[model samples]
Target chain A: MEYLIIIISAVFVNNVVLSQFLGICPFLGVSKKVSTAFGMSLALVLVMGLATLVTYLIQNYVLINTWFGEKMDITFMQTIVFILVIAALVQMVEIILKKINPTLYQALGIFLPLITTNCAVLGASILVVTKEFSAKGVESHMMNLGESVVYSMSLAIGFGIAIILFAGMREQLELSNVPKALKGTPIALITAGLLALAFMGFQGIV
Target chain B: MSKFKYLIDGIVKNNPTFVLVLGMCPTLATTTSAVNGMGMGLATMAVLLCSNMVISLLAPVIPNKVRIPCYIVVIAAFVTVVQLVMQAYTPGLYETLGIFIPLIVVNCIVLGRAEAFANKHSVLESALDGLGIGIGFTLALTCIGLVREVLGNLSAFENKFSSSDGMLVFVLAPGAFLVLGYLMVLFNKLKDRKKKA
Candidate 1:
């Protein structure tokens, strides 16, 4: 039940893109078409989930663990270490995917490189370590490894849904006449505001 | 080109927010108030200045194929430094900016300048470029934050004029998008007018 609430809240009520604004770059850059949006969404889910899991282990074990009879706390290195890890992980994923599965690699190849700079992946990873999660009527506590993975994957799915839906809107928008000054990105941003307004209605749910 | 031109170009012609549209995440996320927006922009500027100078200095030694990662490491180091300093000096602002201070590592503006201008230019020119772009970004963010704060919270730089509450939505998620969209149109019109003149 708690996990379900987390998923609902993440996907609708507190969407990563619409509400939090973590991945606005890709949310705007890649949402021109539904097919492309779908591709980016899949890539995000894979990377966000994997990155969160790895960062969680590192944060718990290496950064804040006891070492040689002394409590070690170098959590400040969290930013540098996680970024390098995510970058290396993305590269490794690209290579391994090419060797093992050619077609999947072809589909996600371009976006994989782009994912390294996508703040949503890094933001979600950091959130897992820093932010505490609580469901409705439940006491808030730090998320364990299992919950963090679920939360990160759900956040990616939420991002996917928002971007895909926005792409559909943009597809139709391309046909309509828009003011000259607000032709491309400006109009898209307004449309996203409307979408975000609609999503805000779900705030009462969780 | 003159060194000063690089700075002016970043502020006007190549303004990161209004023109290049880089670093949208921080522009939208942290600009709930004027002070918050300016804070985020200045923090980003500090990182950009340091990373640009350092990267330009190291461009010769870093392998071409691995320059991106090298840049990321340099950026991450400075971001860490900024994060620590902000935490110590301005804990309130630090609390508000939260994950964004670290996420500056991925901000396209910093990395974009490094790849585009810094590596190709002398250290002094790159630093000037960083300052120009940083000022441009800072100005843009402060503008957005001022608009949002006034319209949403009925305040400017945390000074409340009408305490009864403004639109209320402007401080929320949807308002950021709406305000930025409309501002983009306004900026384009101004730019077009300048071009015609």
Candidate 2:
């Protein structure tokens, strides 16, 4: 039940894109078409989940620990380390995906390379380690590794849903006669504002 | 001089926030208030300027295959430095910005400028580009922040516009989107008219 609540809260109450504003780049960039958004979201779901887990381990077991088995808090290195992990992870995923599933890889196209720089992946990983969680009026310092991974997965799902929906809206929007000034990105951003308002309805769910 | 043009271009022509539309994450997330927006922009500028200069200097040495990773590392280092300084000196802004601070490491504008301008240009030119773009980003955020703060909270900077409640939504997440959307439209309209004239 707790895990389910975590997922629900992540996906609805505190959505990664609309509510939190984590990954607005891809949210605005690749969301022109539903098919492209779907592929990008799938890649995000995979990369965010794996990258968070890997970063969590590195944070707990490696960055914070010394070779002498003494625990030293070198947590400041997290920004650099997490980014490096994400960059390397994206590379590995790209190669493996291309070899195993050429069709999916082709669909992903330029987006796969662009994922390396997506703030959502890096933001989710850093947030998992750094964010403090409070349960039942008890202020827990930070999320445990398992909780972190689950949070990343659910956040990615939320991101996927938001982008896919936005893409659908943009597809229809392309046909509508928008004002000249508000044609491309401006109109899309306004649509996002409405979408965010819609997501606000979920605030009461959790 | 052409160097002067780089500076002017960043402010008006290729403005990072309004024109190029890079770094949307921080542009939206941290512009809840005038102060927060300025703080985030300056921090980003510091990182951008240093990384661009460094990347330009090292471009010849770094292998093409490894350039992106190298650029990221350098950019991340500068972000960390900015993060620490902000935490120590501006604790209020630091606490408020929170995760967005570290997220700056992934900000596309920093890396985008590095790859596009810094790698190919001289160190002096890259530094100028970073400064110009950074200022442009700062100006854009401050403008957005001013609008949101005044409309949402009836406050601009530290001063209150009125005693009564404002639209409240202007300070919220949705407000950021709404304000930025209109601003983009307005900017584009002006640019279009200018081009026609």
Candidate 3:
């Protein structure tokens, strides 16, 4: 029941993209078609979930203990270290994707490199740090390791849902002929606003 | 001098958060209240300006192969100063900003500027560029802060000075998204209008 609540809240109430705005770059940049959005979303979930899991362990064990080797604490290196790790991992995935699936690689293109620095990935890392060490609240109290993983995974799923939904809306938008002033980013943003307003309904539901 | 152009570019055309969208983690994370927004923005601005100048000064001597690592070292050193200064004097701002202060070392805006502008430009030009962009970021984040604090929380300027109790959502995570999205819409509209005219 607790894990279910987390999954629900993360997917809806605390949505990674719509609610948190963590991945707006990709949300705006890549959500052109549902199929591509689905791919990117899948990539985000896998990347963010794994990154969070690894970083949590590293922070608890390695980051904290690096102070012992040197009198000067270097935990301040967390951001660079995590970013380098994520970037390297993303690069590895890019290589495999290129060799294994040229068509998929072509589809992903610039977005693949972008995944390294995507805010959602970094935000997930920070969230792990926040969730684990930060003072507990009612919602956070229910979370354990499994719950944490599920929540991050669901949060990424939530990101995909919003992205794919927005892509669907944009697809429909291409057919409509209305506004001259609000054409590209403006229309997309307005659509996002409506989505956000709708998502607001789920607030406090948990 | 031509350096002023470098400065103005950061403040407007290539503003880090509002325009370039670099280093958004801290911008979104800390801009809950006007106070916190200003605090974090200024803190990062200080580090950016200082690091840029340092990197630019060393750019001529530092080998290109190791440029990135050297920049990171310079950035990390300044970040340490920021962390210690915050820990000692402005504990309030320090506590509120939290991990973001340390995270500034990796903020793409700082690193990007170091590699892009600072590496090519003179030390003084780099400093000017950092200051301009930093202030622009400050302006953007503060605007977001104003919107979130007022609308989500239903009170404006609650934390301009040190006051604890106010509309909590302004400082909450959801409110950050709300403010940023609306502001983006508004900003986009303004730019569109300017282009039309």
Candidate 4:
């Protein structure tokens, strides 16, 4: 029940893209085509899940654990370490995918490198270690490793849903008559705002 | 070109938020209020300025194949410093800015300038470009924050001017997108007019 609540809350109520505002770059940049948006979403899910898992282990084991026979708290280096890890991880994943599965590699080729800087990947990983979440009746506490991975994947799904839907709308928007000044990004942003407002109605569901 | 031109260009022609549209995450997330927006902007500026100068200095030695990771390390180091100092001195703003303070490592504006301007330029020119872009970003964020605060909370810089409830939505997530969307339109129109003039 707790895991279910976590998934629901992440996907609907506190959406990563709509509410938290992470990864707006891809949300705006890649949403011009539904096919591309879907591809990006798949890449995000895979990377976000893996990144959170690795970052969580590093936080618990490497940062807070004993070092050189003396207890040391160097978690403040979390940002630097996690980014370097994520950067290296992305490269490794790309190389492995190229070797093992060229079909999937070709699909996600252009997006893998781009994911390095996609704040969503970094943001979700950071939130996993730092933030706490609570659904309506559940006790609020820091998520365990399993819960963190689940939450990260769900957040990525929420981002996927939002971007996919926005891309569909943008496809229609391309055919419509927008004001000359509000042609491209302006109109797209306003549409996103409306989508965000619509997502607000889901607040109390969890 | 003059040294000052680099700075001014960042503010006007290549405004990070308004014109270049880089670093959308912090621009949308942190601008719920004027003060929060300004704080985020200044923090980002400090990192951008430092990383730009360092990256420029190290550009010659960094091999082309590994430049991106090298730049990321330089950026991540400065971000760590900023994060630690903010946690020590201004805990309040630190809490409000939350993960974003650290997320500065991924902010495209910093890395963008490092690659686009710093890699090819001298340290001083890169620093000025960083400052220019930072100020432009700061001005844009503060403007968005100011508008949202006034409309959403009937306040500016945390001072509530009106007792009556404001739009409320403007202080929320959707308002950030809405405000930025319209602001982009306004900026576009103004730029067009300026071109004609």
Candidate 5:
């Protein structure tokens, strides 16, 4: 029940893209078509979920502990370290996928490389450490390893839903006649605004 | 001087937020109020300037294979410094901006300028580009922030115009999208006419 609540809230109430504004680049850049959006969404879930778990461990064990056995607060190194970790993780995933699932790798292709710079992945890793989550009027609590992993996956799921839906909207949008000034990104952003307005109705659900 | 053109380009022709459309995350996320938006922009500018200068200085020595990671590390270090300074002095803004500060490490504008301009330019030119682009980003954020704050909160530049007159949506996520979308349309229209002229 607790895990379910976390997933629900992360996916809808506090959507990483629509609400928090993380990962808007890919949200806008890759959502031109449903197929591409789906591919990017799958890549995000895998990378964000794994990156969260790995970053959580690194933060708790290595970043917080100095070599002198003193539990020092080196959290400052997080920005540098987590990004490097994410860069390396993307590479590893690419190599492993190529060795085993070349076809899937080909589909994911360019987006996999682009994930290195995706803010959503970096945002999830940082949020797992800094932000707290709660349910049912309970006191807000920082997530443990299990909770962070679940949170990351759900956040990615929310991202997936948003991009896919937006892609569908953009597809329909292509058929309609928009004002000349509002043709490309302008129309898309306004549509996303409406989507965000609709998503706002789900607030306080948890 | 050619250097003056570089500076002017960042502010107008290639404004990071309006023209290049880089660093949308911070632009959208932090512009709830004029002060917050300006704060975020200046913080980013600080990182951009320092990283651009340092990266240009090190371009000769950084191995090609590892240059991106090297730039990331340099940008991250300065961001950490900014984080500490803000936390110590401007605790309130620090609390508000929170994770967005560290997240600056990945802001495309900083890294993009480094890869595209700073990596190849001389130190003086790179530094000027950073300042120009940083100021451009700052101006754009402040403009959006000003619009959002006034329309959403009935406030202008931090002064409340009328507390009761504000619409809640402008201060929320949806408003950010609405305002930004309309602004983009306006900008695009202007650009089209300029091209024709």
Candidate 6:
């Protein structure tokens, strides 16, 4: 039940995109078409889950662990290493994707490059690092491997939902006659504001 | 004569946050109050200026193929320096800025100017452009911060501590998204009216 609450709360109340503003570049950039958006979301879900699992081990066993049975703290090196790992992972996926389905690769091309620098990608890894669970008012300052993967998957789901919704709205907006200046990002932003307001309703669920 | 336009462009006509919408992560995340915005802005400005200066100095020597990576290294170096100093002295502010601080290394505004303006321009020009754009970014963020703080918290620039309870949304995660989204709309409307008149 607790885990279910964690997942649900993350998806709606603490949405990674709408609420936390982690992945706006891709959120606003690739969200024009629902089909492409779904692909990106699926990619995100997988990456977030896998990346969190690996990064968590890296942090606890590598970055925080030292050779010769000693403990080392190179926490500051996180920024560089995380980006490097994420860049490599994204590239590997790109290569596999290109060989498997060139069209899918083309569809994901823009978003893949965009995700390399996405704060949300790094944000998920960092959140699990920083997240401290409080159970029954007692703070558990540590995250086990299971919890890390769970949180990352939950955050990715939240991102996917937000993107699909935004893409749907943008699709409809394409047909609706609108003002000239507010045709593109302006109207899209206003639409986001209303959606954000609706998302705010989820705050009460927790 | 044409040189003056460069200075004017960054402030109003091509304001980084509102008009161009270049770097929204730091703009929205760090601007819970005027104070946080100012601090983050200054930190970003310092890094931008140094990185621009370094890139301009290296522009003549750095090969075209390797320039982007070189610029990333330069920006990341300065960012690391900022990260270390902040972690040591201002741990609290460091925590408040959170991931947004490290994300600065990837901020399009910094790298954008470095690649577009800094590498092509002279050292002095690069520095000045950094100053102009940095100030523009700061002003835009401060505006958002002021509004978010005032409306969300009711206590302007009260990140430190005070007797009153602020609205808290301005500081919370969602508040950043909502604030920037609406502010963009309002800014667009104003620009539209100005163009009409």
Q: Kindly indicate the candidate among 2 and 5 with the higher TM-score.
A: 5
Per-residue CA lDDT of model 1 for B96-165, tens digit only, reads 9999999999999999999999999999999999999999999999999999999998988998998596
Instruction: Give the per-residue Cα lDDT of candidate 2 at B174.
Output: 89
Task: Give the lowest summed-lDDT range of ten residues in model 5 chain A.
Answer: A130-139
Worst 10 residues of 4 chain B by lDDT: B186-195
Candidates' C-alpha lDDT? 0.95, 0.90, 0.75, 0.95, 0.92, 0.79
1 against 6, candidate with superior DockQ:
1
lDDT of 5 by residue, A102-174 (tens): 9999988768988888898999999989888867765689999999999999999999999999999999998
Clashing residue pairs for model 3: none
Candidate 4 lDDT by residue in tens digits, A1-206: 99999999989898999999999999999999999999999999999999999999999999999989999888988988999999999999999999999999999988999999999999999998988877789988999999999999999999999999999999999999999999989999999999999999999998
List where candidate 3 sits over 4 angstroms from the true fold: A65-75, A96-110, A132-145, A174-183, B17-29, B57-84, B98-108, B151-156, B159-197
Tens digits of per-residue lDDT for model 3, B48-103: 99999999889999998877767877887888788888889999888877767766
Q: Which 10-residue span in candidate 6 chain B carries the lowest summed lDDT?
A: B155-164
Residue B163 local lDDT, model 1: 56
Q: Distance from true position, residue A37, model 3, in Å?
A: 2.2
Better of 2 and 5 by lDDT: 5
lDDT of 2 at A132: 81
DockQ of 5: 0.84
Error of 1 at A82 (Å): 0.3
Q: Which ten residues in a row have the lowest lDDT in candidate 6 chain A?
A: A133-142
Question: Fnat of candidate 6, please?
Answer: 0.28
Mind giving the per-residue lDDT tens digits that candidate 1 earns over A44-158?
9999999999999999999999999999999999999999999999999999999999999999999999999999999999998999897677688999999999999999999
* Cα displacement (Å) at residue A30, model 3: 2.0
- How should the candidates be ordered by DockQ, best one leading? 4, 1, 2, 5, 6, 3
- For model 1, what is the error of residue A34's alpha carbon versus the real structure, in angstroms, after optimal superposition? 0.6
lDDT tens readout by residue for model 6, B1-197: 46666666767776778777787778767888887898788788878889998899999999997777678778878888898898899898888888788888778789889988999988877887788788888888888888888877776667534567767655676667667767777777887798889
Candidate 4: regions farther than 4 A off: none
Please give the lDDT score at residue B95 for candidate 5: 96
